[model samples]
Target: MARRKKTSPLEDVLDLLAMLPWWACVMLAAVSYFLLHPLAAPIQASDIQGQGGAMVGAMMQKAVIHGLATAGQHIVPLLCLAAAALSAWRRKQRQSLLTEVAQARNTDALDGMSWREFELLVGESYRQQGYCVAEIGGDGPDGGVDLVLAKGGEKFFVQCKQWKAYKVGVTTVRELYGVMAAKGATGGFVVTSGRFTEDAKEFAQGRNIELIDGPRLFAMIQRARQTQGPSTSEHRESAITTGFPQVQAKASVTEPTANSQATTRPDCPRCGAAMEQRTARQGANAGNAFWGCSTYPKCRGTRATG
Candidate 1:
C-alpha cells in the first residue's frame, strides 16, 4: 500500500472561504458594521452591581469578543472580495483558453502550448460538460495529476500529457486508476495531444479511466463549440444554488492585509477546513508544533509541522 502524502488542514478552510459568494461577504460586512456594532466602552470593574463582580467580568468578556468579531468582519469580507475578484479573472482566462483550444484545427495547434495550459484547456472542456473543475495545484505546479472534476457529487481525476511524439504508456493509465481509488474518486481521464500505446489502451479496458488522444480531443472540441452556449461559470453557480458547493478556485489565495483584523488561520489541505496550531501534550515528541482542524470533534484532520 502506498502511503498517502502528508497534507495541511488549513488549505481546506481556504477552499471554502474562497468559494464564498461576494454578496454574502458584503452582507456580513454590512451586518457587522451596522447591526452588530461593538460597544463604545467595555464594562469596567467599578461598573459592577453590588457584590456582583462576576457580572462585570462577563460583560467585559462579551464586549471584547464583540469587538474582535466586529473588527474582523470589517476586514475579512474585503479580503474575501479580493479573493473572489482574482478568482473570477482567472476563470475568465481559463475559459478563454479552452474556447480557443476547442476551436483549434489539429494537434499541432496544441503543440506550442505548455503542459499547464493544456491542463487548463482540458479542465475547461470538462467544465463545459458541467463538471466542476478544480485545478490540483493552487496556482503552482500540478504535482502530477492535473485536474479534479466533480459532477452530481461524483469526483473524477484527470491527467493531461502534452507529449507530441511519444505514446502514453500503460503505467501512466494504471497510476491514474490507483490515484482515483486512493483519493476516493469515481473515475479518471488521461488526455494527451498524442497517441496511446496498445498496452496502455489494454490496461485501461476494464478500469473507469477514459483515455483521450489527439484526434478524439479534436472531435470533442468541435462538438463542444456546436453545443456550447451558457457559460460554465453560470452553470456552476446555478448548481451551487441547488445545494452543490462551488468548486475550488483556480487562482492562488490572496494574502490578507497586514495589521488587519482578519484571522490568519490556514485551511487544511486535506479537508478544506480551518486549521490552528496545536501541540502534542502526551505523545513522544510532546510540545511540538503542528496543525489541527478547527472543527475538531467532528473532523479529525491534522498536519505535522517543523
Candidate 2:
C-alpha cells in the first residue's frame, strides 16, 4: 500500500527520454523542433480575411494552435536535450560505479551505495553480460521490478534489494515469482546487497530465478569487468578521486584494505561459484576471517582460511 511519488510533467517527459539512448534523445530533440517550428510560424492575417465569422473562428483556432506550438517548439526540444545530457551522465556514472565496485576489496563498497545506485549497478552488470536493460524503477526504492533485462530474445525481470543489514527473505522471492508468471517473463533475478534466507533460495532453485547475494554479486561484477577488458582504469581512478558521498563516508570510518584472498578467490564446494572472505560478526567465531560461499544462506558452504 505504498504511495507512488508524484512527479511533475517535465520530470515524466525527462524520465521517458532517459529510457532511450542519448543519441535517440538528441534525434528526438531535433525532430520535435523541426516539426513544431513550422506550426509555430507566423500566420498571415490576409489568409484569414474573407468569409467573415467562419474565417475569424478558424483564425482563432489557428492562433491557439500556433501559441501552443510556439511554446512547445522551445520547451520540447529543451526537455529532450536535457534528457540527453542526463542519459549521458548516467552512463558515465554507471561505469564509474562498476569500476569502483569491481576493484573493491570487500563488500563494504556495495554497502555504501543508495538503493538507486544499486539498481544502476545491477543494470550495468547485466548490460555487460549482453542484455538490453530498461530501468523502470521510478516508483521508488521499494518498487517492484527494478530492471527489465532482455537477452537472446528472452526477457527477464530483476528486483534489487539494497538491504545492508537483514537478509532477503522468502516473501520477496515469492513476489517476484508471481510477477514473473503474470508478466510471462522467461526468468527472473532477485539481487541483493545482502544474503538471502534459506527459504528464499529453496523457492528460487527450480523456478528459473537466480538469487544473487552480496558476495556473488561482487564476483559477478569482477568477472564482468574482466570480460570487458582494460579500459576501466580511467573510470576506476575517477571513482576513487570523486568518490560517491556515501562510499566516501564509509571509507573514512574504516579504510578499505586489499584482501589477500581476493587474488585467489576460492570456489564453493557445493555450488562451484566464488567464495568470499568474510569475518564473523557474532558468536564464538566473531572477528575470525573465513572463506564463506558467495551464495551464503543459499549454499551454506564455508572453508577455513587458516
Candidate 3:
C-alpha cells in the first residue's frame, strides 16, 4: 500500500484554510493585513525618549512585536490568499467531477476514478444537498469513514467505497452503523461505485443507514446539479415566512390555485417541457399529486411527488 505523504506545518495550515470557503479566506487575508500592518510599522523615537530604564524594556517588547508582525504581515496574508486560491480550485474540481459523472452514459465514470477522487465527488454531492460536509481524510482507499455531514442540527457519517468490481457487503454497512452509534450520529450512508450484496441491502433496511449504489448515486448527483439554486437556508426561511415545510424542487404538494404552486417546479424528464402538479384520478395511486408534463397528451412524461 502507498503511504500518505507527511505535510509541513504551513501545508497543514493551508489545508485547514482550504476547507473554508474561498471568499472567507480572502476576507481573512484582508483582515489580517490591516491588523498586522500597524504593529509592523516602525516605532516613533520621541515616544521612547521620556523614560530611560522603562524605555529599554518597552522598546525591547515593541521591537519583538514589530519583528514578528513584520514577518507575519506578509506571511499570513500570503498564506490566506494561497489557501483561498486552493479552495477555489478544489471547488471547481469538485464541480467538474460532478458534471463528468452526472453526464456519463453509464457507471464507467465512477468506476474509472481513483478512491480519493471518488471521496471528493461524494462530498461534493452532499454539499450540493445543503449539508456542510467535512471531509475526514481516510487512511487508504478502503478507509473507515470518509465524510462528516451536518445539517438541521443533526450529524451524519458517510463512507465512500470506490470498489469497481467487488460488491459492498454487509460487513461494511455494519461497520458504519457501529461507528455512528459510537459517535452519536443521527444517521449514516455507505456509498459505493458498484452494487451492494443482498445481505448488505437487508442490513441497511430500517436502520437509518442509506446504501447508495452507483446508479442511485449518479442520479443523486444529476438531481443536485439540476436543482442547485436557492440554498437550504433560503428555503428554510421561506418556509418559516410562508408557514409551510421546505419544498423540494423535484416534488411539491398539490395546491388549490395554480398561482399558489411552487415556482421552482422541475421540467419534464422526457420532453424537457415545464411540468405542473397533477392528480391521479384512477389506479393504485389515486388522489396522489404528481408532476406531469404540460403537453401531457403529446409528451407522456410524469414524476412522483415527494
Candidate 4:
C-alpha cells in the first residue's frame, strides 16, 4: 500500500496558531468582562460616602484588573494575526512552482519562429485552419503577388514579399490592390517580414486589404510552431480547392505619376481600378514604359495598348 504524505509538524503548528488570533481576541474580551465584575457593584451603591472606603478600594482593584485584561486581549490578537501571515507565506511558496510551470507553457506558445517565414507560413497555416489556397505567380506583368486563398467561400489575394529585414512601402500594397480587383478577390493579404510604413498601414485600413507585419507575423508563426506537426500544405490538401495559375510579372513598366496622390495609370480596362507601372512580356515595349491596372489577376487590364 502507498503511504500518504504527511504535512510537516512545524507547518501544522503554524496553521493552527495563525487562526488563534481571532478566537484569542474573543477569549480575552470575555476574561476582561469577568475581571470587571466587581465594578458592577458601584452602580448599585446609593452614594460614594454610603459605600464607604472599603467599596472605593474594591472599585480600584476592579479597574486595575480590567485594564490589564483589555491590554492582554488586544496584544494576543495582534500576535495571532502575525502568525496567520507567516502561515499564508508558506502556502504561497508551495503554489508558486505550479504557477511558474503554467507561465512557461504560455511563453513558449508565443515566441516560436522568425519573420522571414511568416508569409509562406501564414497562408499555409490559414489553409490548415480550413481555407482554400490559390497561389498566383510566374512572370506575367503585375506585382509579384504569388498567392490567393479562400475560406468559407470568401476570397482573398495574397502578396508575399520575402524581404527578411527591409520595410515594405505603400507602392507594394497599392500593386496588390490591382491584383485583388483583377482576381475579383473579396480581400487581399500583404504578409512581410519587415514593418509597414505608416502610410502603407493607413492605406490598408477600411480597404479590403489586411497587412501582417513583422511583429504580428512572428506571433502567428510562434502559435503555429507551438502546435507543430507538418507543413501546412500536407494537413489541408483537401481544403485547398482552387487551381490558380503561376503567372509571372514581366519587366518593370513605366507609368505616369504626376501628383503624389494621383492615380499611376489612367484606369484598368478590365477591373476599372487605377493602373500602375508594369512591364509586358515578349512585346517590343516589353521593357518599355506602360501603365497596367492595379487589378491584375482578376482584371488583366493593361494600358500598354492604350
Candidate 5:
C-alpha cells in the first residue's frame, strides 16, 4: 500500500480555510463571535420580569449577532480581494522578469550578475513555468542546492554554478545525484555559464539530472520571448521597475544539425512546447550539447541528453 502524506494541524486548517469562499469566512467569523461573546459576558435575564427578561435577552443576542454579521459582510470581502490582487501583482512581476531574461541576446548580461541574482533569475524562470520555487543559500550555505522547485508535492533541486571560465565536469553531476539520493528528491539540475566535460556528460546520462550551459540558456531566453509574444511594453516595465537596461542581439544558438531532430523538438516539461537542443556554454552533461525549452523563461523546461 502507498503511504499517506501527513500534514500538520495548522496546514490542515489553512488548507480548509483556503477552500472556503470569502463570504463563508465572513459568516464563520460572525458566527464564532456570536458563540464566544456570550461566554465573555454572560447574559443576566434573571433581573427582569420573566417574559420581559426572555424578550430582552433575545433582543440582545439578535443585536449582537447582527452587528458582528454586518461588520464581517463589510470587511471580509475587501480583505480577500486585496490579498488576491497582491498575489496577482507579484506573479505578474515575476512573469515580466522571466520574459526580460529570455529575450536577452547575449550571456554577457548574465556574466555580470552575482550568484544571488543568478539564483533569483533561475527561480523566477521556473516560477513563470508554474513551479513554486524555494530559494536556499540565503541564510547560509545550502550544501549545494540554490533553489528547490515544487509542484503538486513533487520536488526538484537545482544547483547554480556561475562559472564562466571552467567546465563543469562529471564530479559535479555525481555530487548532485548523491544529494538527490540523500534527500529523496525527484530530480536535480546543474546550471553553469561555461561548459561541461565529456566525462561529466557520460556520468549524467540516465540520471535524473540536467546540465545547462550558456548558449542553451540564451536560446531558451529567446524561445521564452517568442512564446510570450515579446512586447515593447514589457521592456519598459522591467526597465522602470528594476533600472536594468535590456541587452538584445541576435546570435545563432546551438541546436541539432540533424534534420530529424530539427523537425521534432522534444515537448516542454512545463508547457508542452517543443524542446530544442541548445549547447550550453557549459553544457550540463557534455560541454557540447544540452536540451532547453524552445519557449524558455516562459516554459523554463529542459532535458539532459547523451
Candidate 6:
C-alpha cells in the first residue's frame, strides 16, 4: 500500500487558532453578565416603607440601573479597541502582499531589459543560447566592454548600451570592430536598446561584427526563457515572447557550392511557407541536403530528412 501523507503540525495550529473565536467569546461573556446580573432580586420590595419621606426601595433600584449603564460605558471602549486592532493587522497583511507583487514585477523588468543591457541580462538568455558571459566594471577607458563572452572555441567581444531614446551611431560600432580585430577575436556584438543609425547598420554589415537591436534582443531573451522551461521568477526570463513568429538562426547555411541553389529556406513545414534553416558546415546535412518549410516566414515550420 502507498504510504499515507503526513499532516502538517502548523496546519493544526492554525485550525486551533481559528477555533478560538476570541471576539464571539468576549461578546457572549459581556452580554451574559449584563442580562444575568440584572435578574437578581432587589434588596427591598415596593411595599417597604421609606426612611425619611423618600422610598428606600425606589432609591436602591435607581442605583442598580445606574450601575448597569456605567458597566456598558466601560465595555464599549474595550470592544472598539479589539476591532481596531484586528483591522490594523489585516491592513498590514494586505500591504505585505502588494509589496511582494511589486518586487516580482521589478525583477521581470530587469530580465526583460532590451538588448541594451545584454551582457547584464546574460544569465537567462545567452546562457541558454550556448554563450557564456562574464560581467565586469571598473575605471577602464573602454567604456564598459567588460563582459567576457565565449561560445564553442571562439571568443566574442561584446558591448552593451542601454540607450532607449537616442540612436547609437557609427562611432560605437566602429569602436567595437576595432577592439574585435585588435584582440584577434572570432567575432563581436554591439547590443543596444534603441535603433542604430543607417550608417551604423551599414558599418556592421559584411564585417565580423553583429548589431543586436532592441527587437531582436527582446525576441532572443523570450526564446531563451521558453527553452529553459517555467520559472517562479519570470523576471529572469522576461524576454520570452508571448506572440510572435518563431525565431530563425543567425545564418541559414554555413557553406554553399558555386552552383548550389539548394539554400536552406526559412519557411513553415506545415503551411508551405519559406522556413528559416540553420545548419553547421560540418553537420549531418553537409553538402547535399536542404530543408524547406511548407510555410514561409508566416509559419516558419521546418522538417529535415536525409
Candidate 3: count of backbone clashes, pairs at least 3 residues apart or interchain: 0
TM-score of 5: 0.46
lDDT of 5 by residue, 78-185 (tens): 454544344345445555565666757677756766665666566666544444565554223445777766643456788887787779888878977887888887
Candidate 1, residues 1-306: lDDT per residue as tens digits?
111255566444444444444444445546645543444345465655554787767777767776776676556556556656645655676667766766677656677777767776776666665566666642323325777777545677788888876899998888887777777876778899899999998898756677889887776666655656646554653344334454543333334445664444554432334577788887786988787777664445565664
Q: Which candidate order results from sorting by TM-score in descending order?
A: 2, 3, 1, 5, 6, 4
Residue-level lDDT tens digits of model 4 in 193-253: 5678898987876576777765655554444434434344333433432233222222233
TM-scores of the candidates in the order shown: 0.59, 0.72, 0.70, 0.38, 0.46, 0.40
Candidate 6 residue lDDT tens string, 1-306: 011145587444332222222343355446645664544334445545668547765677666775665665455445434543443443333233323322342333433343423334533344345444443331245544645455434566667776766888999889877877777776677776567999998898667666777666655565554554323223212212222123333344434546875754432222222354445356565664456453333233335534
Residue 170 deviation, candidate 3, in Å?
3.4
Model 3, span 1-306: residue lDDT tens? 122488898898998788777777899999999999999999888757548789899899889999999999999999999998997787778888988888788777887787878888998887667666776665534338888766545667898888867899999999889888888887788899899999998898757677889987888888877777424422322222222332333433333565674445665543335688789999989999998888756455566777
Whose TM-score is higher: candidate 2's or candidate 5's? Answer: 2
lDDT of 2 by residue, 1-306 (tens): 132378898798798677666777889899999999999989998757658799989899999999999999999999999988988788888888999999999888898788888988998886665456777783543338888765434567889999977989999999888888888887788899999999998888756688889998998899888876534322322232222111111011122347632244655433345677799999899999998877766766566785
**Each candidate: what lDDT?**
0.64, 0.74, 0.75, 0.51, 0.59, 0.49
* TM-score of candidate 6 on Cα atoms, chains taken together: 0.40
For each of the candidates, give the backbone clash count.
14, 0, 0, 16, 10, 22
Q: Where is model 1 poorest over a 10-residue stretch in terms of lDDT? A: 248-257
Give the range where candidate 6 is weakest over 10 consecutive residues by summed lDDT: 235-244
Q: Which regions of candidate 4 fall more than 4 Å away from where they truly are?
A: 1-119, 225-235, 241-306
Q: Indicate the residue-level lDDT of 281 in model 2.
A: 99
Candidate 3, which segments miss by more than 4 Å at Cα? 1-4, 45-56, 139-143, 229-306
102 in model 1: Cα distance from truth in Å? 2.7
Model 1 whole-model lDDT (C-alpha atoms): 0.64
